[model samples]
Target: MSTASIPKCPMCGKPRSAEHAPFCSTRCRDRDLVKWLDDGYAIPAEPVHPFADSERDDAV
Candidate 1:
């Protein structure tokens, strides 16, 4: 496949490597891992009331 067809690294905007796949280098891959370990990324979820669990239990 042509390099132009391959997507750029999400971390560095450089060409992606076969070894790293989505990242340009091990450094970029590691940086992404660190970001995840440090809670730099988050998934959104619906907010729940603090007493929601208790309320449900009481209703049963």
Candidate 2:
């Protein structure tokens, strides 16, 4: 395969390391984790009603 086709580190754009298949180094791996921990990424989701569950209660 061509080097151009090789995957790069998501955080720094460097070639990925064998030790860290998707990241070039532990730093990059940790940084990516930080992004996840800090809520830097978001998934496409349907907007949820704040009171959807409560509104369905028939007991009241």
Candidate 3:
């Protein structure tokens, strides 16, 4: 078995619990949630032009 198969807690670097597969405890889990809610995490995307929809319709 590869040790790489084992998952570590994202917050504290502890071995993950089955109950919390990615986070070691509820506290870590909640912290992650709060980060998302507070915009601590973000996904980058290309900006969409407001007239892009109109241009697509004209092409069709």
Return the top candidate by lDDT.
1
Candidate 2 structure quality by residue, lDDT tens digits, 1-60: 888989998888999999997999999999989999999999989999998888889556
- Candidate 1 ranges with C-alpha deviation above 4 Å: 1-3
TM-score computed on alpha carbons, candidate 1: 0.74
Each prediction's whole-model lDDT (CA) = 0.94, 0.91, 0.89
- Expressed as tens digits, the lDDT of each residue in 6-59 for candidate 1 is 899999999998899899999999999999999999899898799999999999
What's model 3's TM-score? 0.61
Q: Model 2, which residues run further than 4 Å from truth? A: none
Every model's TM-score? 0.74, 0.75, 0.61
Better of 2 and 3 by lDDT: 2
Compared with the true structure, the alpha-carbon lDDT of candidate 2 equals 0.91
| Colliding pairs, model 3 | none
Whole-model alpha-carbon lDDT for candidate 1: 0.94
User: Residues 1-60, candidate 3, lDDT per residue (tens digit)?
Assistant: 676787989998887888987898999999999999999997898998999999999999
Clashes of each: 0, 0, 0
Q: Model 3's lDDT to the true fold?
A: 0.89
